[model samples]
Target chain A: MKFDAQWIAFITILRKEVRRFTRIWVQTLLPPAITMALYFVIFGTLIGSRIGTMGGFSYMEFVVPGLIMMSVLTNSYSNVVSSFYGAKFQGSVDEVLVSPTPNYIILLGYVLGGVTRGLIVGTIVTLLSLFFTDLQVHNVAITVAIVVLTAMVFALAGFINAVYANSFDDISIVPTFILTPLTYLGGVFYSISLLPEFWQGVSQLNPVLYMVNVFRYGMLGVSDVDVGFAFAGVIVCIVALFSYSLYLLESGKRLRN
Target chain B: MAHALLINNLHKVYGNGFEALKGISLQVEAGDFFALLGPNGAGKSTAIGVICSLVKKTSGQVKIFGIDIDKDFSAAKCELGIVPQEFNFNQFEKVRDILLVQAGYYGLPRSLAEERADKYLKQLGLWDKRDTPARMLSGGMKRRLMIARALVHEPRLLILDEPTAGVDIELRRSMWSFLRDINAAGTTIILTTHYLEEAESLCRNIAIIDSGKIVKNTSVDSLLKTLNLETFVLDLREPLEVSPTIENFSLRLIDSQHLEVDVTKGQLLSDVFSRLLQEGVEVLSMRNKTNRLEELFVSLTGSGAGENDEI
Candidate 1:
C-alpha cells in the first residue's frame, strides 16, 4: 500500500477496535473502574489503615500506584486478546487480509487499540485512588513515560496471545493461569523489598515486577529495583514481542490459511 | 496485459499434505463474465482463495490488471474484490456500517465511503435493512450484503464464490441482472457456483476443475459444443397405452403423457417432430431434460457432479 493508504488503513482498524470496546462500555470500561474503586475501599481504606506506613509513605499511598499499574496491565492484555480473537472467529480478519493494508499497520492498529484501553482504565483507577488518599506525581516525565510504555508492552503481549489463540479459551488461559499470578506477585500490593532475600531474587526475574516497580518509582519516587534496569527491561520486552507479532501476521499461520 | 486476471501454473498444498490445486492456469479478459465450475472439493474456492490472498499459494504467479501479486501486491489487491462462499462479515454490525467500513479498508474517506456504501446498499435492495443488524438479515439478504460490501470499493475485478447460493428465484434473478449490468459497464467478474443453470445463463467463458486439475477451459459456447447428445422431455398431445419404438433416436416412455427423447448432436429437432407426427403422436411442447451446461458438467466431472452439491 502507498503511504497515505497505509495510514488510512491503520486508522480504520484502530477506530474499529476502539469502537468495539467503547460500544460495550458496561463490560469494557466500567468494570475496571468499579473493581478498582472497591479495591480502594477494601484494601486502601480498611486493611491499609491497619497496616500503617511502608516505604516512607502511608500504606494507602503506597498501594495506589500498584493498583493503577495492575489495572493498566490487565486491561491492556484483555482488550487485544478479546477483540482480535473476535475478529478471527467471525472471519472478519479476512476483510483486512484481502485489502491493500500492510502487515505492520494491522499489528500497530490492534496494539494501539489495546494501549488506548489500558491507559483509559489506568487513568480511571488512578482518579479513584485519589479519593482514597492524597497522591502526587513524583516525576511528571517519568509518570507519563512509564504509563504509556507499560500499556504498550502489555498490548503487544495481548497481540501475540490473540495470534496464537485457536479458541476463546486459549485467549483466556494465559491471563487466568499466568498473568493474574504475575501481577499479584509483581509487587503490586507490597514492595519486593518487603520479601525475603531469596524471594526478592526470584521476583527480579518476573517481568511484571519490573513494570510495577518502575511505575511505582514514577509515582512514589522510590523503587526496589534499579530505575534504569526497569525501563531497559520493559523496552527490550516491547521490542521483542512487537517483532514476533509482526512475524506472525506475515506468516498468516492461523489467519490466512 | 489485456486480461483483468491472470493465473499461471498456480498450486496449493494444505499443511495436511493434501494438494488442492495442481498447476492450474487461467486468464480472464477485461469486462468478461467468467465461471470457475467444479464439484465438491474440486478446488474452486481454493483458487479464489489464492487470488484474493485469503489462502497463501504454494507456488505460482497471479496478476490483477497486469500487476503481479508478489511484486506489487498492494496495486494488485486494490484492483480486486472477493465475496467468499460463506458469510464472513461481522454479524453484529449494522448493514450500512458493514459496507461503509469495507470502503474504509480501501482508503476511501468518510464522505466517499458513505457515498459508495449508500450506492451499493440501495443497489442490492438492502436499503430498508440498512439500520438492521446483519445477524437479523435472512440467509439470502446476508449473501446480498456480501455482494454489496465487495462492490463498495468499485474494484476492476470482482470474484463471487457462490454469491447466489440458496437465494429464492426472484432475488437470484435480480442478482443476475445486477451482475450483468456491472459486467456490461466493464467490470471483470469471475463466479463459482454449484448451480449450472446460473453459470450457463451468466458466464461467457468457463473452466471445469476436478481432483486438483483443470478438466476443461473454454468459452461457454465451445464447452456446450462438446455435448454429444441431449435429452429432451416432450409433453405429448395425447396419452399412449403402448409405447412406440423409434428408429435412429433413443426414446423412453416416462408416462402416458410424457416421453424422454435423447437426440444426438447435429440432429435437428424438426426430425423428431416429423417422426412423432408420422407415429400419430402429435407433439405438444418440450424442454431439455437438464440444462445443456449441466449435462456437460456432469459428463466432464464424472460421478462427482453431485446434482445437489453444497460446495
Candidate 2:
C-alpha cells in the first residue's frame, strides 16, 4: 500500500480504538479517576497526616506524581489489553488483518490508542489530585517525555499480552497478578530510600520502580534512581516490546489461523 | 480475459495434523460467478481462508488479479474482499460506521468512503438501519450488512462463504438478483453454498470438492448434463397396493400414496405417465427428488446429500 493509504488505515484503527473506550466512559475513564481520588483521600490526606515528608517533599505532594504515573501505567496497559483482546474475541481484528494495512501501521495505531487513553486518564488523575494537594512540575519536558514514553512501554506490553491471550480470563491474568502488584511495590506511595539497603537493591530490578522514580523526579525534582538511566531503560523497553509486538502481528500469531 | 483468482497446487494442514486442503488447484475467470460446492470438512472454507489470509497455507501459490499472494499479499489483497460465514464485525458499532471503517482500511478518502458506504447501504437495503447497531439487526439484515461492508472497498474479487445460509427464500432470491447485477458489472464472485439450487441458478461455473480435493470442475450446464438419471416423486391420487411395472424405468412405492420413479437420459416422461395410467394409477403431482446438481453432487461425493443439504 502507498504511504498515504497506510496512514489512513492507521488512523482508522486508532479512531476505532479510541471510540471503543470513549463509548464506555463509565467503565474506562470514570473508575480510574474515582479510584485515584479515593487514594488521595485515604492514603495522602488521612494516612499522610501522621507521616512526615519523604524525598524532600510532603507525603501528599510526593505521592501525587506516583499516583498519576500509576494511573497512566494501568490505564495504558489495560486499554490495549482489553481493546485488543476484545477485537480478537469478537474477531473484528479481521477487518484490518485482511486489509493492505502494514503490520507496523496496525501496531502503531493500537499503541497510540493505548497512549491516548493513558494520557487522558493520567491527566484526569492529575487534575483530581489537585483537590487534595497542590501539584508542581519541576521540569515540564522531562515530565511529559517520561509519561509518554512510559505509556508507550506499557501499551506495547499490553499489546503483547493481548496477542498471546486466548480468552477473557487470559487478558485479566497479567494485569491482576502482575501489573497491580508491580505498581504497589514500585514505590508509588513511598520512596525506596526508606527501604533497607538490600530491599532497595531488589527494588532497582523492578522496571516499574524506574518509571515511577523518573516520573517523580519530573514532578518533584527528586528521585532515588538516576533519571538518565531510567529514561534509557524505558526507551529500551519500548523498543524491545514494540519489536516483539510487531513480530507477533507479522507472523499472524493468535490473530490469524 | 485475465483470471480473477488462481490457486496452483494449494495445500493446507492444521496444527492438529489434519490436512484440510490437499494440493487443490482451481481458477476463476474475471467477471464470472462461480460456485465451490462441497460437503462439511471438504476444505472449502480453508481454501477461502488461505486466499483471504485468514488461514496460512502450508504450501501453495495463490494469486488475485495476477498478483502473487506470497510475493506481495498487500497488493493482492487490495483487489480482494471476503464475507466470512460468521458475523465478524463489532456488534456495538452503528451499521454505517462499520461500512465507513472498512472503507477507510482500504485508504478511501472520507468523501469517497462516505459515498461508497451510502451507496452500498442503500443498495443492500440497510440505509434505514444505518444508525442502528449491528446486534439489533435480524439474521438476514446482518448478512446484508456484511455484504455491504465487503463492497465498500470496491474490491475486484469477492468471496462469500455460504452467503445465503439460513436466509429466507424470498430474501435469498433478492440477494441472488443483487449478486447477479454485480457479477454482470464485472466483480468476480466465488460462492460456497449448501443450497445447490442457488448454485445452479446463479453460478455459471462450479467445482465440487470432496475429501480436500476438487472432485469435479466444469461449467454448471455441463455438470448438470452429466446427470443422466433423475428421480421424481409422484403423489398418487389414490393408494396403490403394489409398485407399478414400468418397462425400462425403476419405480418404488415410497408409501402407498407416493411413488418414486427414476428417469434416465432419452426416457420420455410421457411414457411413465402412460404406463402408470395403463396400470390404473392416477398421479396427483410430480416433483424431482432433488435438483440436478444435487443428485450429481451426491453421486460424486459418495456421501448422502441428507446431512449436508440445507435446501
Candidate 3:
C-alpha cells in the first residue's frame, strides 16, 4: 500500500475502535469513572483522613496521582484486550485481514485507540480527583510524557494479550490474575520507604512501581525511585512491547489459519 | 484476454495433517462467470481461504489480475474482493458503516468511501436499512449487506463462496441478477454454490473439486454434454397398474400416476411420449428428475450435492 493509503487505513481502524468503545459508553467509559470515584470516596477521603501525611503532602493529595496512573494503565490495557478479542471472537477482524491494510498500520491503529481511551479516562479521573483534593502539577512535561508513555506500554501489552486470546475467558485472565495484583502492589497506595529494606528491593522489580512513582514525581515532586531510571525503564518497556506486537502481527500468529 | 485469477500448483496442508488443496491449478478469464463446485470436505473453501490470505498455503503460486500474490500480496489484494462463506461483519454496526469502513480499508478517502457506500448500499436494496444494525437484518438481507461491503472497494475480481446458500428462492434470484449485473460490468466473478441449478444458470465455466483435487474443469455446456444419461419424472393423466414397456428406455413406476424414466444417449423425449401414448398412457406433465449439472456432479464426486456442506 502507498503511504497515503496506509494512513487512511490506519485512521479507519482507529475510528472503528474508538467508535466501538464510545458507542458503548456505559460499559467502557462509565464503569472506570464510577469505580475511581468510589476509590476516591472510600480510600482517599475516608481512610486518608487518619493518615497524617505522605511524601510531604496530604494523604489524599499523594494518592490522587497514583490513582490516576492506575486508571490510565488499566484502561489502556483493557481497551485493546477486549476490543481486539471481541473482534477476533466475532470474526470481524477478517475485515482487515482480507484488505490491503498493512499489519503495522493495524497494530498502530489499535494501540492508538487504546491510548485515546486511556487518556480520556485518566482525564476524567483527574477531574474527579479535584473535587476531593488539590492536584498541583510539579512538572508539566514529565507528567504528560509519563502518562502517555505508560498508556502506550500497557496498550501494546494488551495487543499481545488479544492476539493470543482464543476465548472470552482468555482475555480476562491477564487482568484478573496479573494486572490487578500488579497495580495494587505497585506503590499505588503507599511509598516503598515504609516497607522493610528487603521488601523495598523486591518492589523495585515490579514495573508498575516505576510508572506509579514517576507519575507521582511528575505530579507531587516526590518519588520512591529515581525519576531518570523510571523514564528509561518505561521507554524500554514501550520498545519491547511494540516490537513484540509488531512481530505477532507479521507472523499472523493465532490471527490467521 | 488476461485471466482474472491464476493458480498454479497451489497446495494447503492444514495444521491437523489434512491436505485441503493438493497441488490444484485453475484459471478464470476476466469478465467470466465461474462456478467452483465441490462436495463436503472437498477443499473448495480452503482454496479460497488461501487466495484471500485467511489460510496459509503450504506451497504454490496464486495471482490476481496477473499480480503475483507472493511478490506483492497487498497489491494483488487490492485487485480482489471476497465475500466469505460466513457472515463476518460486525453485528452491532449500521449497514452503511460496514460498507464505509470496508472501503476505507482499501485506502479510499472518507468522501469517496461515503459515496461508494451509498452507491453499493442503494444498489443492493439496502439503502432503507443503512441505519439499522446488521444483527437486526434478516438472513437474506445480511447476505446482501456482505455483497455490498465487498463491492464498496470496486475490486476487479470478486469471489463469492456460496453467496446464496440458505437464502429464499426469491432472494437468491435477486442476488443472481445483481451478480450478473456486476459481471456484465466487467468484474470477473467466481462463485461456489450447493445449488447446482444456480451454477448452471449463472456460470459459463464450471469446476468440480473432490478429495483435494479437481476432477473436472470445463465449460458448463461441455460438462452438460458429457452427461449422457438423463432422468425425467412424468405425471400421467390416468393411473397405470403396470409399467410401460419401451425399448431403449429404462422405465419404473414411481406410483399409479407417476413414472420415472431414464433416457440415455440418442434417446428422445418425443419418442418416449409417442411410445407411452401408443401404450394408452397420457402424460400430464414432465420434469427432469435432477439437474443435469447435479447428475454430472454426483457422477464426478461420488457424493450427492445436497444441503449442509460445511467445508
DockQ winner, 1 or 3:
3
Per-chain TM-score (chain B), model 2: 0.92
Interface C-alpha root-mean-square deviation of candidate 2: 0.8
Q: Where is model 3 more than 4 Å wrong at Cα?
A: B303-311
Consecutive 10-residue window with the lowest summed lDDT within model 1 chain A: A1-10
Best by DockQ: 3
Worst 10 residues of 1 chain B by lDDT: B302-311
lDDT of each residue in A1-257, candidate 3, tens digit only: 99999999999999998998899989888998999999999889898888879888888998899999999999999999998988898888999999999998999999999999999999999999989988899999999999999999999999999999988899899999999988998999999999999999999999999999999999989999999999999999999998999888877789888
Q: What is the TM-score of each candidate's chain B when compared with the real chain B? A: 0.95, 0.92, 0.95
Worst 10 residues of 3 chain A by lDDT: A248-257
Interface RMSD of each: 1.0, 0.8, 0.6
- Interface C-alpha root-mean-square deviation of candidate 1: 1.0
In model 1, which residue pairs have backbone atoms overlapping below 3 Å? none
Native-to-model Cα distance after best TM-score fit, residue A43 in candidate 2, in Å: 1.2
Model 3 clash pairs are none
Off by over 4 Å in 2: B236-243, B255-257, B274-284, B303-311
At residue A106, candidate 1 shows an lDDT of 89
Q: What lDDT tens digits, residue by residue, belong to model 3 across residues B1-311?
A: 55899999988998899998888889999999999998988999999988999888999999999988899999999988999889999999999999989998999999999999999988999999999999999999999999998899999999999999889999999999999999999999999989999999999998889888888888999988888889999999999999999998899999999999999987788999999999999999999998898888887888654323212
Span of 10 residues, lowest total lDDT, candidate 2 chain A: A48-57
lDDT of 1 by residue, A1-257 (tens): 67877788788888888888888989999999999999899988999999998899888899999999999989999999998888899998889889988889989999999999999999888888878889888887888888888899889999889888999999999999999999999998998888999999999899988888878888889888888988898899889999999998889878888
Worst 10 residues of 2 chain B by lDDT: B302-311
User: What are the chain A TM-scores of the candidates, in order?
Assistant: 0.98, 0.99, 0.98
